[model samples]
Target: MAGERVSLDDALSNVDVLDDLPLSDQQPMVEAQSCSVVYTANFDTNFEDRNAYVTGIAKYMEEAATHAELNKLLEEGEQHAVMLYTWRCCSRAIPQPKSNEQPNRVEIYEKTVKVLSEEVKKLTKFMKFQHKAIEVFCNQVKRLCHQEKRKDFVSEAYLLTLGKFINMFAVLDELKNMKSSVKNDYSTYRRAAQFLKVLSDTQSLQESQNLSMFLATQNKVRDSLKEKLQTIGAHEELLCEVVNISVHMFENKMYLTPKEKQMLVKVMGFGLFLIDSDGCNINKLDQKKKIRIDKIDKIFKNLEVVPLFGDMQIAPFNYIKRSKNFDAKLWPLCSASTISPQASLMCHLPRIREEHIKYISDLARYSNEVITTYKETARTDAENRDISDLAQRGLMLLSDWTSVVTEVYSWKLLHPTDHHANKTCPIDAEEYERATRYNYSPDEKFGLIEVIAMIKGLQVLMARMEIVFLDSIRKNIYQELQDFVQLTLRDPLRKAVKNKKELLRSILVSVRETSADWIKGYEPSEDPALKGKKDPDQGGFEIKVRRRNVGSEELELSLYVPPGPSSTQLYMVRTMLESLISDKSGGKKTLRKEMDGQHLVLIDEFHKTSFIWSYLLNFSGRHAPCPCNFPNWHGHVRRTTCLYPNRHGHVRRTTCDVPRACTLTGTGMCDVPRTCTLTGTGMCDVPRTCTLTGMGTCDVPRTCTLTGTGMCDVPVPVP
Candidate 1:
């Protein structure tokens, strides 16, 4: 029995684990065991009865051996049996069909990906349902291990497999929780999207028909509101004007009056009310709010709703004004008043207008400081430098300015200039050609043109400002005169002067003369009387120099000249203009050399000159000779004496000059000539001897053939 136990131990120890073997090799071992069972069952065979006896014995012995081995495994080391069974049942890879084909890399890759994809697709579901299966398996293993028949079972492989199953169950529970959270998020998001879609489909007014209907409804409502406001008397009449005034006053640190407040309440319509400083309701209106203008005025006039505190403190601008002793800031706490729970707190909050005003002023001050620094820097850099140096400095300034502007533009507060939009100059062909003659980078050229346009716009703005200032002054003076006539002196004649038709012309004339004189010093380079071909009502300057050929169409040149402070810059600009006017390309090039790199600057400084030319042009007639080419405007001398037409209707003749400079015989008068239908006789009245002398100097000879009698001073002729 000891030897047999030793032999059994050795055989069991010699038994090899086939866990890692391929199914092809493993299947043969199982077949061998079955074949041994068949051989043992068939040990006794009686030919005919052998088959039946073998089958019955083989089935009984196979069942008995399996049961007995299982019992032994459980009593000894059930963990090893469980591990081996679990590996075969659950963890083993699926077996491929038996074939002699070698593994293809492509097919292997495809198969591996397919398997992995399937596993990933079901991983979430697997993790969810796997915990229960793992738990059951662990419990069964524990039961087997703790069983009275197999309590001592211990296998390292089985222990390791059990631990892995336990760990997998724990990880699967955590995974299940994660999947549940993800599902919950997805569901919530879907529900929210569904709600939003439903709401938008039902309530959105962006559809064309809906938008039109809404707009029509809004118009009707606005009309009704305006009619209601109009029926409200003085409040209605002053509402629009007062709203603007109040807002302006508000910006300037002034509080709104009752009228202004009432107007705002009516116009703004909702989400507003008047309140006292103490968190108390001075007045409240329904959500469909309206206030009687008279009531507002009365409330302020009567000085209602005073608090307990006195006037030792300065009241906030947003707070209601109170009587002297009740104007204190702490009055809200001391006073007993009706409180509101639902009112907007902002409506009752005191606004320190002075504080806001100070803040705005500070911003303005800072902006002005920056502007001053820029101006100073630009001016200083430009001073004492040649054109090239100035241009380099200006380039630096432009770089800085561009950076600053880029930042400002990025803020999206204002639209930037579209350099490509309508990128062409409105000038004559020659002028356009001249402007484009200088080669420059596209960016530089565009910038130069845009800056020139901006400079023009700036000048226009300044001119407008000047005109407004002048108009204001005139109006003020006129008002003063009317006041003097109506109020102070009470002179009826002067009052008549205001309304009388006859005096109207004189008054206008006086006003015009006064205005002219007032702005004389501030006048630009042009005379206002002849400012441009454009009408006075148009209110801008334009200059054009045209040359008219006698039989051809007129050629034109538009000019834009900007003004500058520097004399040298101004001189260079003047030189360029003179050259342009004289049609001398050489002169232009000379000036260009002198003002190198300062083309933009020089051109901008000619605004005043252009304005002057435009002004002078306005006084001239359409048929007038072009100023650019005065006498030889048509490329030739049109006249020898007078540039314009004279009284004689000839270009050369004046009123005093006669057509004939000399009569017959070429003297001032026809003395020696004899031609007379009036005399009724034709004769050579001169002496024959004097005729002998052929000299026609005085029609007399110094020494002649006929008479040499000291040579008669008068001419002698013979016929």
Candidate 2:
């Protein structure tokens, strides 16, 4: 997963920042991530003004071509479909109520129906507009293609006709998705609310028996929707299949294949005659007397499953990126048979191609640089910075080209909805001042072509930066982890030796499996060395075993006596002096201490015979951080001095001011300095907290848990 390309899902997951957010914040976090710039890129509907208008036109025309001379008929179809769906769903949610169920189920259902119907009316208006636009666009194409050179114009005319179907496919797909997914459309709130009302308290709801009945009701209402959807899905699938064929024909040199080459030659010649020229060859009129522009629609209707477009051999794409242009040579299958007046406009079509490409690329580059500057503050480490700016800056188009892109994509431009009344850019109010300085004028920076370029640039930049960020992050993580591995790996014999008595007083070890001699060392309570004497006689000695490290093994010597601080030195002393044995069987370790709250712990169990220089002097030369995080952990392991003068002078030796304190571990007890007001207790792990004095020993479990809700969710013992 770390090595694989970051998908939209992964990027969004990180935006949610799963680990940092509380469970309660999960839903909102997900919503926020979806609302972020990355998610907005996936939503193609948010087009600029010019593009949206164009797309709107394209959409309505396609809907028109589907019907004959219908103004509101297609829209009515959309309304009927949505209304039936809404009513059925609400009606099912409130089953007959059995005469004893919820009192106002019917009233609630009826109100829901009314609300849903009201919403459908508004939604249908967009659909109706979309239908009209589609029809108008087709009509425009029909008029544009009436050509004197019909054969030459056929390809250009066919491309636009082809786009009509593509646009329809895109619009309808978006509509279907919004209708089904609640995550996409918040307008589905009513239906979601009804669902929640019935399935409320999912964790402990009492309607377990009625679950199946509820499901059945949902199925009953959704059955019609499902059928309508399946039909649409089939059509979309076919539409996509056709679009893929068109794209291949347009892009990959449609005449490369011998058969396709023959088709293009014939189509061009036939198109020229059908436009405005009188027919020279009678053979061109095979199916009809005249090759007509409207006949192009018939080709789509009965498109043969000829293996010409699909499932054919193709050239490798390796050099395609470096190639100068998209091989635009193509056989216009739509115009393969006919030409008309509409085909005549190809000669008039402006050669604004390069201008459009440049506009898109330039806008993409600038946007990426902007997003990059914003992100750099968050990416603090210079070592972490690399070739992760946005994607390849897209080409810059002219204002006109930008407008075209926006219009074609059906996105709203950065302009007011009523562009005719007020020629103003509808930039976010907060950024208006900055935008003006950035050369984004209030009026001129819009329309179909320009808006399209901006959107195209935005999408390219969004995907590009995301790719770059993830790629750089992957490399950074790999290097850091490798360096960590290299640190210990450089030395074959050296291993990390952590002293436990200084940290928590308990030890752990991992060693290799093949070594005969145990290489075990412990922190000296006093002496610097003696290779950490292992006296077999002293019961401190336990079994020896082998452990593994970096695939190598060394014998590990562990002293494990039965549970009772068998892990501590006190247990060893008890084992030696059988006479002092008292059954405090399995009692939790407690560190009882008293202090004026000024003295610090040095070390315990100093094996040195010298008392004065045993601990304090040993650590005198070490560096102490200005604000040492570990107050209890003295810097050095050899020396420990807890000056509890009130008790005994020996340190690491438990001293109890409570009359009788065991001189275990041969260490000093708690120190009572100049003031006799301080009471001193022995040091241990689970020592009870003193309520009156507010002081405790720093042994056993060392962490101080903060009380109350804001603290970590570390589980507490029930007792």
Query: Which is the leading candidate under lDDT?
Result: 2
lDDT of 1 by residue, 244-290 (tens): 33333323322212222222222221111111112322232211232
Segments of candidate 2 deviating more than 4 angstroms: 1-106, 145-167, 170-719
lDDT of 2 by residue, 1-719 (tens): 67889889889989889778667421211000122332211111111222222212232224323323232343444453443233222222222333537787666555544444544444444334444554553344344333422221122223423443332323232334333322212234334345446436764243322322322233222232223323221222222223334444433433212223223322222222222112222223323433332333333312211111111111112111122231212224332444322212122124354443554465456446646666412232232323322121221112223223222211111221433333453344223222222223332333222333333443344434453344333333323323322221112112112221221111111111110122243322332112223334555433322212112132121121111111112212212111112111122421112111111111111111111111111111111111111111111111222221222223343321122111231222211111111222211112233333444532222222332333121112212
lDDT of all the models against the reference? 0.27, 0.28
Q: What lDDT does model 2 reach?
A: 0.28
Worst 10 residues of 1 by lDDT: 306-315
Residue 171 in candidate 1, Cα distance off native in Å? 88
TM-score of 2: 0.20
Residue-pair clashes per candidate = 13, 95
User: How much is the lDDT of residue 261 in candidate 1?
Assistant: 23
- Candidate 1 wrong stretches, greater than 4 Å: 1-374, 377-517, 521-719
Each model's TM-score? 0.14, 0.20
Cα deviation of 179, candidate 2, in Å: 7.3
